[model samples]
Structure formats: C-alpha cells, structure tokens
Target: MRIFDVAEITRNIKEMCIEANYSLTEDMVSVIREAAKNEESPLGRRILNQLDENMKIAGEDQVPICQDTGMAVIFMDIGQEVHWEGGFLEDAIQEGVRQGYQEGFLRKSVVGDPFGRVNTGDNTPAVIHYQIVPGDSVRITVAPKGFGSENMSRIFMLKPADGVEGVKNAVISAVKDAGPNACPPVVVGVGIGGTFEKCALLAKRALTRPVDQRSGIASIRELEQELLEKINRTGIGPGGLGGTTTALAVNIETYPTHIAGLPVAVNMCCHVNRHAVRVL
Candidate 1:
C-alpha cells in the first residue's frame, strides 16, 4: 500500500480551480475554432470568433472566461490500496476551493442556503463525488458548472415503452426549449437508462469527457453523432443569434436500469464547458 498526503489533494485542487476558470481544454478550443469556420450564419460565425478571442484574452490576462465562476464540482477516483494522511480529506478539499477562489480572484457564486440566498463568502463546500478503483493512483476532475446552461438541464422518466425514439425527442425538446438561455453552441451531456438521480449524475459526468470523443459502445456512438447533428440543425446558433452552429457536441453515458423504467437526464453546458483533470 502507498501513503497519500491529503495536502497534495488540496494543492492540486487549488491550482485546478484556477486553471479551469482561466482556460478550456484543447479539444474544446479546437472544436469551437472549427465551428466558427463552418458556421453558415455571419452572426453565428462572428459570435464564435468573439468566443475564441475571449478565450485567448482570458488565458493571457489570467482572468475567468465567464463572469459566473460557478459552483465547483469535483469527481475523484481513488485507489483502494492507498492510505490518506495530513488531515480530514473533506476539509482539505473545501480549503482548496476557498483559497482558489480568493487567491485567483474568481467570483464566489455558491450560496450558503437554498432559500435564504446568502453568498458562501469563499465558495466552500464544493459538490464532490468519490469512486474507488483498483489502481494506486488517484484521478481528479474539476468541472466548474455555470448556471446559465445548468439551469436549463432536465430529467425525463420515460416508460420503458418510450424506447430510443422517446429518448431522442426528450433531448431535442430540452434543447429547443432551452434555446438561447442555455447559451447556444452548447455541449449536451446525456444520461440514459439508470435510476433518476444516477442518470443525472451520469449526465453530469459525461460533460467531463472530451467533446470530440464518442462513446466506445458502437450504438451509443451513433446516437451521439445523430443527436449532435439534430441539435445543430435547430438553428439556435452561437450566442443564440440563429445559425447552424447551435451545439458543439452531444455526449451520452448509460447504465442498466430497472425493467419498468427508463430514466434520462440532459445536462446542458455552455460553450465554456470548463473542466480540469489531474492524476496523483
């Protein structure tokens, strides 16, 4: 067994929080750049160009790409053979978020209470998910989810009879209704066939996958491509000005479900689908 220092987790998370806010992954950047070129509408193409320029400036200036710095969502895959030391792991993670937001000058958008609506002061208590695996190394993924697109996400509990066609319609309808509000030129993360909450989590996790990457499962890959094509055809376009570049990608994840139920969740993310990944 190997000893792991929880302090390292804290240090990495702090840097990751700052990194994710300042820039997007190369795959995401490349896709957006390509979209700008192929965009059929002048306005859409112009909006994409502005987005590209914004990304460039954010990196150079060390500023967040979006005003909403977002609530931190962290996913961790921990190794079973590892032992943690140096303090409570949970506290360390929260401290990392607090420090990152304060030091990096990223906006603190997390509220302490749902209804009372007071700011959390330092963006503490991130939404964290943990998983155990066989390896000795830990993998961390930080996704800063902006509410502009998050608020438009949806979950549909379709009867098993609804099948594949219904799944497609549910996703399409969500995108149609979201329109500009979801920050068109979106990345759609879809979860199909699981319990209600599980599907939502799956959908959220799907966003962490590279936009250009498709599911390894052949059928799911086809569905992803088809959904992406249909979503782009919706004419939502970049910045919702109406064009052919509505969505950048559609990523889907699936798990086995109950015989009687088919739960589907659609998690919407803006063009700035921000996430940073690291391993230790």
Candidate 2:
C-alpha cells in the first residue's frame, strides 16, 4: 500500500488553488484562440481577443483572471490501497484552501451562512467530492467555480419518454434564457441520467473534462458536437452582443438511471473555467 501524508495533500491543494486562479489549462487557452481566429463577427473576434489578452496578463503578473476568484471545489479520487498518516484528511484539505486564499491574496467570496452573509475569512470547507477507485494513486482536481455562469445552470427532470430530443431542447432553452448572463462563449457541461443530485454533480464534473476532448461514448460524442453547433448558431456571440461563436465546447456525462426518471443538468461556466489537476 502507498503511504500518504495529509500534510502533503495540504501543500499541493494550496499550490493548486493559486495556480488554477492564475491560468487555465493549455486546451482551454488554445480553444479560445482558435475561436477568435475563426469567429465571423468582428465584435465577437474582438471580444475573444480581449479575453485572450486578459488571460495572458493574469498569468504573466501572477494574478487572478477574474475578480470573482470563486469558491474552491475539490475533486479527490483516492485509491483504496492508500493509507493516510498524520492529521485528518478533511481538515488538511480545508487548511490547504485556507492557506491558499490567505497566502495567494485571492478574494474571499465564500460565506459562512447563506442568509447571514458573513464572510468565511478564509475559503475553508471547500465543496469536496471524494471517489474511491482502483490503484494507489491520488488524483486531485481543483476547480474554482465562479458564480456568474454557475447561476445560469439548469436541471430538468424529464420523463424517460422525453428522450434525447427533450434533453436537447431543455439545454437550448437554458442557454437562451441565460443569453449574455452566463458570460458568453461559455463551456457547457451537461449531465444526463442518474438521480437529480447525481446529475448535477455529473454536470459539474463534466466541466473539468478537457475542452478539446469529446465523450468516449459514441452517442454522447455526437450529441456534444451537435449541441456545440446549435449553441453557436444562437447568435449570442462572444460578449453576447451578436455572433456565431456563442459556446466554446459542449461536454456531456451519463450514468444509469431508474426507468421512471430522466434527470438532466446543465452546468454553465464562463470563459475562465479555472481548474488545475495533479496526481500523487
């Protein structure tokens, strides 16, 4: 069995939080660059160009790409064969976030209470999703999700009879309603099947998938391509002014579900879909 220290987890998480806020993965950057080059509308092209420059500045200056900074969302894939040493794992994860926000000088956006509106001071107690998989390595993904696009996300509880067409319509309607609000040229993460909550998780997880890649499932890949085409055709443009490059990519994830239920969720993310991955 592989022996892992909780302190190491803290150190890595801290660095990841800072890194993710500073820059996006190469796949994401390339896609936006390609979009700007191919964009038909002059205004859309300009907006995409501005976006690229802003990202460049953020990385060069070691600053956040967007002011929101976002609440840290951690996905931990822990191996069953691994054994933890030192302090509690959960506390270490939270400490990592706390230290990252404090040391990184990132804006603190998380609140301790929903209605009270008190700041957490440090962005502690990140929304962590843990999964046990084969092997003895830990895979960590830190995704700082800003609220602008997240607020525009939607979930649909359709009948199994509603089928694929219904799913397409629901996602399209959500984007139409979102319009410029989701911070156009968004990457859409879609989850099909599973329970209500599971579907939402799936949608959020889908966003972490590399933007340049498609779902391995044949039907899902086709759906992803079709959705990307349809969304761009909406004329929402880059800054939502008007154009053909409304969305950068459409990623879909699926899971088995009950016969009576067809749960679908759309998790919207803006141009700065910030995330960083590391394995230990």
Decoy 2 TM-score against native: 0.99
TM-scores of the models, in the given order? 0.99, 0.99
For residues 1-280, write the lDDT of model 2, one tens digit per residue: 9999999999999999999998889999999999999999999999999999999999788888998889999999999999999989999999999999889989899999999989989977699999999999999999999999999999999999999999999999998888999998999999999999999999999999999999999999999999999999999999899999999999999999998999999999998988999999
lDDT of each model, Cα atoms only? Answer: 0.94, 0.94
For residue 52, give model 1's deviation from the true position in Å: 0.4
Q: What C-alpha RMSD separates each model from the true structure?
A: 0.7, 0.7
Q: How close to the true structure is residue 278 of candidate 2, measured as C-alpha lDDT? A: 99
Model 1: per-residue Cα lDDT over 41-160, one tens digit each? 999989999999999999888879998889999998999988999998889888899999999999999889999999889987799999999989999999999999999999999999
Candidate 1's C-alpha runs over 4 A off are none
Give the clashing residue pairs of candidate 2, or none. Answer: none
